[model samples]
Target: MARYRFRFVACDEGFLRTFAGSAWRGAFGGALKRVVCAMRLRPCEGCPLAGTCIYPHLFEGRQGADPVRLKSLDRIAVPYVFELDDVVPRSFGAGSEVTVTLTLIGDANRRLARSYP
Candidate 1:
């Protein structure tokens, strides 16, 4: 497993609810797809690139093209998680900083490292 920390300084005043995990996850997923989807395929069900695409691997937990194998598994847990501090204030003023920690398990870190670097 590997961990990474990202810091963001608010440019303007904003309010984030306490326990913003869902909000963060939604934003991250959308942004990731936008940045990585090359074929512009909606749903990604039959896209030829799904097996090797980072978007599906990270967001949808899809591994490969084996239909039977994919159907046999009930659920494939996402390979990454978010670690947020409970004590951080939810509301932000201009210049307020927020730190988000992400942990990637197993081959996830290695896969992403190749994509990014």
Candidate 2:
């Protein structure tokens, strides 16, 4: 079984679990495809459900992830880092990028999504 490393530049977990599902090889023992990840949301802002959301409980860290969801299978949609533009300094914001790595175990799938440019 091969595990993966994901570097979600300025992106959050929710986006990966939700919208991107239609784009790429989703977490069904998925593969590490090319992605232009970026974190657009902040802990204090962005997510409307944050006020009463249980994301904290679902996720392991303050960033929150669904371990039960992750452990359910041998694979996961791991959105490790969340980078935001507001926090960036000048060129950093424009140059910053998100990187994700996935280690394929079995029955991996992939569908590339068009991002950037």
Candidate 3:
């Protein structure tokens, strides 16, 4: 397993302060999914390649059969874990910074992190 750390600074103080945890997480997930999904399909069900797509497997997760029927086991195990530092301030100014940690395991660790376009 490997962990990557990222630091981000809010450009606008007013905007940063308004974002709560769930709101910020949704935005973050949307941005990450957009970069990873090459097909850019709004709905996963409409995508022809969804069965073999890496983005859905990692983000949306595998569906269908759950033979074991474990509790809350609707999807396959996720390959990465996200950890946001708990001490982050509720608000930020133009220069305020926050750190995010991602722990990658299994196949996810083998993929290289790179800038798209």
Candidate 4:
């Protein structure tokens, strides 16, 4: 198990204020896919590389994967977990920072470490 910490500063306080937990999660995952996805597909359905793409592997798990290794399972476990502090304020001011801790397990650590800085 390995963990990586990241800090993100909001450029627009107004924008940050609009996000609730669920909305923030959706936006965060969308942005992460955009950052990592090579094909830039709007929906990853039927993507040729879904089995190997880091975006899908981390976010969606392996869909329709062969169950030879893990019997009767459609997808494997999501290899990373997100930890967000509960101390967030109602709204952030400009240049406010948030810390997100990502814990990677199994092959996720090695795969991400080599590709991410």
Ranking by TM-score: 1, 4, 3, 2
lDDT of 4 at 91: 69
Worst 10 residues of 4 by lDDT: 14-23
Question: Per the 3 Å backbone cut-off, how many clashing residue pairs does candidate 3 have?
Answer: 0
lDDT of 2 by residue, 14-104 (tens): 2333334233333322222112112233342455543223332212122222333445453344433222223222222333464444443
lDDT (Cα, 0-100) at 22 in candidate 4: 49
Compared with the true structure, what per-residue lDDT tens digits does model 3 show for residues 1-117? 899787888777844333244555566668777876767647776677665555655566553232333436656776677677645446667887777777777654443342232
| Local lDDT at 26 for model 1 | 82
Could you give candidate 4's per-residue lDDT for residues 1-117 as a string of tens digits?
Answer: 998777888787743342244455576678878887788656777777666566776777763343346656657887777676545446676788877677788777766765587
Which residue segments of model 3 deviate by more than 4 Å?
14-24, 63-74, 86-89, 111-117
Residue lDDT tens for model 1, 5-87: 88888899987776676777788889888877888747778788887777777778876445344577633778899877545
Those runs of model 2 whose alpha carbons end farther than 4 Å from true positions after fitting are 6-17, 26-93, 107-117
Between candidates 1 and 4, the one scoring higher on lDDT is 1
Off by over 4 Å in 1: 65-75, 86-89
TM-score of each: 0.82, 0.21, 0.65, 0.71
TM-score of the candidate numbered 1? 0.82
Ranking by lDDT: 1, 4, 3, 2
Regions of model 4 farther than 4 Å from truth:
14-24, 63-71, 114-117
State the displacement of the C-alpha of residue 95, model 2, in Å, after optimal TM-score superposition: 1.9
Each model's lDDT: 0.75, 0.32, 0.60, 0.67
